[model samples]
Target: MIIESKVIQGKKLIFNFRSAKKEDASNLSVLRLKIDEETEFLDREPGENFLSPLDFEKLIYEDSISEKNIFLVAEIDDKLVGFARLQGNNLSRFRHKAEFGICILKDYWGFGIGNSMLESILMVADSNGIEKVSLYVVETNTKAIELYEKYGFKREGLLEKDRIHKDGKYYNTVLMGRLANKLKSQ
Candidate 1:
């Protein structure tokens, strides 16, 4: 399930977006840790990622074959700078829905990479008959929230004290979702 696409960033950078490959496992492992360290917005803490390259390779292999899952990477000058994933349930009752998550290096922020990745993933979801896509975002991520909203995702609920950060404080998580049929209707 490879996605072939490209985006221009700030009139200078050219970003290549595609599905993650087994060969990317090593770089992704390192990049994931770096991204987690760069921000508390993600679910993991720095040095908390325990997955090895082999684990990532296995996961990518599984995701590649799963109709309800996709792993995407954004690369600039052949360097992995961002990534996004879509995870869907296998149960009969929840087959029409999926959850999406995205992360980009702090230095690469505001470059339209996230936007491109979301659009591409949504396109894949829609093509695969995924009726709804949902995600959880920390309440303080206004930029991400705004981006999601612009893509027709509505806040469905808030989970209080959902995440504890390095500041030793609890933060709420916003649950947001978008319905493919609804988007088409609107």
Candidate 2:
């Protein structure tokens, strides 16, 4: 796919929003861990058997051009601060849909980085022939929910008590989705 690069947030940041490169794997993995540490709503802890940076590098090299999977990273001042991924089955029957996920460092949460990253991902998905994109968000992540809603994603269902955190408390998971056609229609 042909991805584009642009700057956002009044030029305070620059977003390439392109396919993840092998060199980016290490930074991407680190950013993922940082995001996980900042948010307790995730299903797993940051140190719980997370994939190695080398493994992520290999995966990115292998699947970088795959139509059913897309990985993106947001860099500012040549540092990776956030990343997003979209994955789906390659089989013809399920090719129209994809699962999406995103993470950003805590310090970058309110700086329009997430919004720019997500918007770029949605555009990439739409251009790649994906009909719908789905994601699960913990109920406590109101800011993320608001961002998703602003981008036209709607709550499709709920998975109650879906995740048990280290605190021994269960949290509800909300499934949200948006159709490319629906977004275009709006």
Candidate 3:
């Protein structure tokens, strides 16, 4: 699905948000590794579970064809800086829900990129018949937790020892979800 592109003005910086395309595979491959390297907040280690351009291309293609899934990217000056994805389930029992995940370059963390992306994805997901969105955040990430709350996601539960960080400490994961407040009609 094609998403209308929009510019988000951040704290002295601006970026474009749009649906990811096949050509974005290479840049996304590099950016994903960089994002993972920059923080322990994400699930993957820097190089672990790495996705090659082909792998990303496949995902990009699948997302493009899937009505319930979306792959969005953020860029500045034509350079890809961040991305987010909404993955929907196949089974009828879980088809109304999707899992959301996002990542940005560490240098662009506070520029409202994440906030805008979340809002955009949610709006699109609702229009596509997704009634609920879910995500998991590391417990220590107060900034993320606050952002999620501000967007209407409530803490559903906690998974103790969900992650073991680089510092060799166990970290819990906060499970959060939000039901569609207003479903958009196509």
Per-prediction TM-score? 0.93, 0.88, 0.95
Q: After superposition, how far is residue 73 of candidate 1 from its true place, in Å?
A: 0.6
Per the 3 Å backbone cut-off, how many clashing residue pairs does candidate 2 have? 0
**Can you rank all candidates by lDDT, best first?**
3, 1, 2
Identify the runs in model 1 with alpha carbons over 4 angstroms from their true place.
Answer: 5-12, 182-186
Show pairs that collide, candidate 1. Answer: none
Candidate 3 lDDT over residue span 49-116, tens digit each = 99999999999999988998889999999999999999988899999999999999999999899999
**Candidate 2, 14-125: lDDT as tens digits:** 4454567887877777777778888886666987758678988876865576876777777777888888777866878878999878877877778777787787778778
- Name the top lDDT candidate: 3
Per-residue error for 184 in candidate 1, Å, reads 5.9
* TM-score, prediction 2: 0.88
Whose TM-score is greatest here? 3
- Give the Å error, residue 102, model 1: 0.7
Tell me the spans in candidate 2 whose CA falls farther than 4 Å from its real position. 10-17, 182-186
In the predicted model 2, the residue pairs found to clash are none
Give lDDT tens digits, candidate 1, residues 1-186: 566566556434678888999999999899989898899898888888567899889989988998878999999989999999998888899999999999899988988888888998898888898999999999999999999999989999999999999899999999999999645687
Colliding pairs, model 3: none
